[model samples]
Target: MAKQKKGEKAAAGGLREQLRVPAGPVDLTTYDTRATPGFDGSKDDGKVALEGLGAEVSDWQERLFAEGRKGGERSVLLVLQGMDTSGKGGVIRHGAGLMDPQGLKITSFKAPTPAEKRRGFLWRIKQALPDEGMIGIFDRSHYEDVLIARVRNLVTPNVWNRRYDQINDFETELAAHGTTILKCYLHISPEEQRTRLEARLDDPTKYWKYNPGDVDERQLWPDYMDAYHAAIERCNTPEAPWYVIPSDRKWYRNWAVTTLLLETLRELNPEWPVPDFDVEKEKKRLAAT
Candidate 1:
């Protein structure tokens, strides 16, 4: 994998190779939250780099959407997992915002209702899956079942523990059925989260976005990190690899995820569907009419 020079795209597989977590024992402590791997640029450069990707990504997205509508089975599912204020929403707003809304199916998963809980953790997830030829973005995804459930003890240890295997199997099925899965764990430091939370509190307009519960959740940071380690370790597969995005800098986080999605779209390489009818004949018929 080549490195990404300032104001340039990464070498083929550069950022993806740099950020992808290899299968093995995982350590959250060892990963740096502030480091910008692959991207060697200043903040302004990073913002410009991200802006440059909008046109290409949107073009590829439309191609994929067209392919899907023309009996294509392929699609993409981007699963975003992060702690409070780690910028999942920011990535979506800035990254996926580049694509056409008609081609995107964005799902933000909240705490499950009693009925959802009864149906099982993945039931609602399946419901929100993108149709053929669409790009699906999950702000918070099924991994929450293991992460939050384990840390909060929302479910018994046995149930959440068993979900690790279930998730891998489910993703395998999805991959087999032409759904490309890209899971990103936005890794941000506790200090950065505090700063973001404080900034939100200091601004009157941001009060609507700030939640009192986020402060409470902050106390259990260690427990949540441990849960994340396990979930990434157990569920990280070739079919659905997890990328640990260093998210302390909001610009880099948004740029990195967007680049990864662009790469995945390029790999899919969806093209405009061919017209079934003879174009010259149709043109002639139309001209005569």
Candidate 2:
């Protein structure tokens, strides 16, 4: 496949390649929230692929974990940013769920506490980054500083505007330090968001997941969209690229994310670290015992 020029939208191809956000200005309207572009499979095929990916992900994660345990410097951080009801949790449940809990670090960022605010935005975020040889998932990450902070006017324009540079510098540093960053923006339509929110009200089981504030935030849809567009365009870097996953169809969303992650791990090719001790000696000692 030919290389895509900077800011050129992804061409029709593999699922991971198609969903990648091109470098430069991003107009969210160009992406279809409901269409499964690269996936030619049925819903069942998607589901089965997801399930199959789980095992592959688990094996790779174990190797990564072992690599780290044996002093390898490698890790993965998956940043998930989306509107309410966009299935961040679902991706965690269905995709990351298959990995060993010990090797996976998942953090769900909420509103900053008093102390967290005093320290600065990225302080707490720095604390949650995954250690070597682990897979870290950020349910709502530092990008919230740009998205919600910009939309809600939590900070001055000077502060929020500068964050694009700050974030780019931060992620670039992460990439230099052996962390593979995969940032995903779950793209969902306002109409689809409304339907999902309404379903929460109708089903008692999902009531706990509903937040009344989400409805108010929905009122600022256009502002949030603009915020997202700016964020993706400004911070979409070669070190840590962004993938815009169409999320109206939950199955496709899950499948696409899993596939993207699988592809990243495959590229990283984290191998099990070589043993420090002699295998023959250890085997002989065990046999003698």
Candidate 3:
């Protein structure tokens, strides 16, 4: 596959190539999710993958907090978008579980309230943006305006069509404001989703997770795929590139997200700034006390 030029729309072939996953439903049986010598999420190698990822996150968190103390505010925003039963919840649970909770915020967006709908599609979303020195994770983000709304025909063609550019501008503004945006679309095959959905129905403990509406949504898989293709093509910008993560193997998905996040945070070079205080005066004050 040819490399997509910068600013060029990502074609279906290019996305599949970049993600390193087969074009259709993947057979999870062929791949190993267990921690091994090479794979990051293997449980057998003392869960080395998870431990290393956790350490990397901790280092970044320390730097970010130090920078925060110094009054240099840098923020990170992670957007996760995917189909129903695509392991978005699990990814949030395991992937973000290692990060410092005090420095991180997770917001899961559901259907908008009547008040929110009265505003703009992005009104509620922009309100959730991360503050400086914080990491914000969106379980389902603004992409829904383009994806589900398009799939379900909730909005007019012209309205949803305009959202592609709207989203790009919104993200670019975030990047300009010293917020690093990492967008990931958890790619899973229909079969994998079906299996997971079935597991939810069969287990009593997981039954609460099962929703009848999911079946209706699955029926429109083709529509969703088309919407996803268009949304990624239109909205993936140089400043905020979308990563299509192969999520059939939960371990791989976790490792990929964690690694990407660590690398992005490391690149920001978060550090503690110098305090504005007179050392001698402070010491004298302490002595007097």
Candidate 4:
């Protein structure tokens, strides 16, 4: 991953290009959660890079919003999946925080209630979709069906096994209908996760964010890793790709995700759209008044 060009966007190659999970059986074990894959800078330098991207990210988001208002069906949906304390919240707060909230939809999926369970996994997900011309972020997403559902044995092997194909079909439909999907698996080491979770317990203000159940889930790390590996492999397609963000370092995580998104939006090249009305006539009318 090389530095971006000054006046031109290196949308086709660079950090974003390297982060994407290739099409095949992905071994999460081999991915270095601690390695800052594309970034060769210090933590402070990463922070500066992220700051530089803010205005550009906002501009791109506004253009996409305008494109939607002008009748373009295109939009973006970012799906985030990872182990607990993998910095998903940090990404939203720091990365997505740079964009306009009105143009963004953020959904945090929790354990389904009885009513939701009756309707099926994606039922609740469908309702949270971003409107045309909007960008959507899923803090946790539909992949929970295969991840948690499989690990916890909430669904039978035969059932969860079939969900991979179902998810692919669902994403295919969304892509065909004018949505660009970017799914990210935040890669964080177990050691870092423990440190973060412990810090949460130590800070009274952060206590509310900690769930004891997360400790239970830690015991199933190998299983969850397997689940993630399968999910990434089965769902990684040309239409929608998965990017594994090395998230042990929060600064690097923020920089990498923001960089990828900036490249994506730039490639989309959303325009501010021509006004349907006559601009000169409107200007004349205003001037006369």
Candidate 5:
């Protein structure tokens, strides 16, 4: 998709335009996660946008729950795939903060357990699949098998290549079972990532977030980029289209994610069914009792 000009209307024709960024390094701090005109991070405007978006999310969630109670067969699965410092955690934290905890589940996939390793690569992932009337967010998901494993030479090229078909089939099965998969790739530049990493090291409260190994991963940036590009090209399907979110600007990432999720939930149009009961009859029965 071609990059979009800033401040354009967000209709279908404008969607492609929204994805574009200006050439060269974009400033990360100028965008505000809480603001609608996120290009400028005004606190008051940001707060208003955040509150409005939060209210909309809450409304949709309530409707979804009601629809689920009425036996509606709908579920949403959001997969967040990115490099080590790509702000996946931050996006999940802020974008999903407004959701009802009971209706949402987050799964962060790590190195496979021994039992998982013995089974197919997708075995562990299937266990985290969302049930009806819920949203499931996967932090680092099944794509790791095709991406990191392939980049690190942990799997044969043939084995990793086959995972494209495997993942597509898995997602197809989910769609058949009323699950809609929304995948997002947070795209951050190397320099922006370095700044975040340094901030983690400098801030005492965030010291735990600093892992020296993350720096090591930075060395293989090109390899990982290649892996991600290939994985996205091969695995992005009609059942699950991947949205490449530009993350050099953190606020824009948050806004884009929130907007996308809101749009998706709204499209579901979940609603509560009217209860089948006569108020007068109920009142008469209560009076007799």
Candidate 6:
């Protein structure tokens, strides 16, 4: 769990180091959507692996939560982003579901309200940050300002352009205050997305998850890619790094993210806080009663 040096190869095919967005330009095409990097397993194996993490991850999260409750300042923020049908919900359901809900703060961002726009994009985001010792999960996050906002012209070029620095500064501030930020771009191909969308429509149970607007957005995939490229290239820093999760295989995506969470928890190594009172005295008083 040692932090790898800048140029050093990650030990054990470390997913964080293996999947990290490299310095310089990013070409999404270069990353294979179906790849299950660092995992030499089939779909069923992936599922079992994820299931296997349920207890260990849950235990680590409880340690973190206990620490936070006992006045620890360290927290974790996991940012998830991708095109429609990239399985942001799936990750939460299969990965985060392994952990205690009390230890997690999950937010699913919708379009900004008129009131929110007045306050700014990050305003609501700041409010949702996890308390010390907790893990905060963003289903979609402030990067939307640079992603959807830019792609849709929600703001002027000059405005959106300046926000990247604002975003970086904000993340820096979060890191300075002990937030371990993990930004994941759930990488999925257009074809895979279409297939997923079609499945949603075909299954009556998933009808509510489908949206006609997603199709409209799909047509502009290339433009969104450009915006994502800029956002990742501009805002990717040592404090808040980006990891591209190859997401075509649902099982792999779920397992990989869960694995990343597990590794991060291991790296954090949050210990349960010790009792401040005299344990023997308290036990004796109870025994006497």
- Which residue runs of candidate 1 sit more than 4 Å off their true CA positions? 1-6
Error of 6 at 232 (Å): 0.9
Q: What's the number of clashes in each of the models? A: 0, 1, 3, 0, 5, 0
- Where is model 2 more than 4 Å wrong at Cα? 1-14
Tens-digit lDDT track of model 6 for 1-289: 3333222223574678888899889889899999878777777777777787788889889998888888889999999999999999999998999889988999999998999999988999998998898899999999999999999999999999999999999999999998999999999999999999999999999999999999999999999999999999998999999999999999989988887888888888998899988999999999999
Which runs in model 4 stand beyond 4 Å of their true positions? 1-12
Model 4 agreement with the true structure over 36-56: per-residue lDDT tens digits:
866677878778778788889
Off by over 4 Å in 3: 1-47
For model 3, the run of ten residues with the poorest summed lDDT = 1-10
Instruction: Give the top-scoring candidate (lDDT).
Output: 1
TM-score result, candidate 6: 0.95
TM match of model 3 to true structure: 0.84
lDDT of each: 0.92, 0.88, 0.75, 0.89, 0.75, 0.90
lDDT of 5 by residue, 96-140 (tens): 887778888899998888899899898889899877788889999
Q: Order of candidates by TM-score, top first?
A: 1, 6, 4, 2, 5, 3
For 100-150, candidate 1 gives per-residue lDDT tens digits of 988889999999999999998999999999889999999999999998899
What TM-score, computed on C-alpha atoms, does each candidate reach? Answer: 0.97, 0.94, 0.84, 0.95, 0.84, 0.95
Candidate 2 structure, TM-score to reference: 0.94
Give residue 190's error in model 3 in angstroms: 0.9
In angstroms, the error of model 5 at 193 is: 0.6
Residues 114-176, candidate 2: write the lDDT tens digits. Answer: 899899889999999999999999999999999999999999999999999999999999999
Of 3 and 6, the candidate ranking higher by TM-score: 6
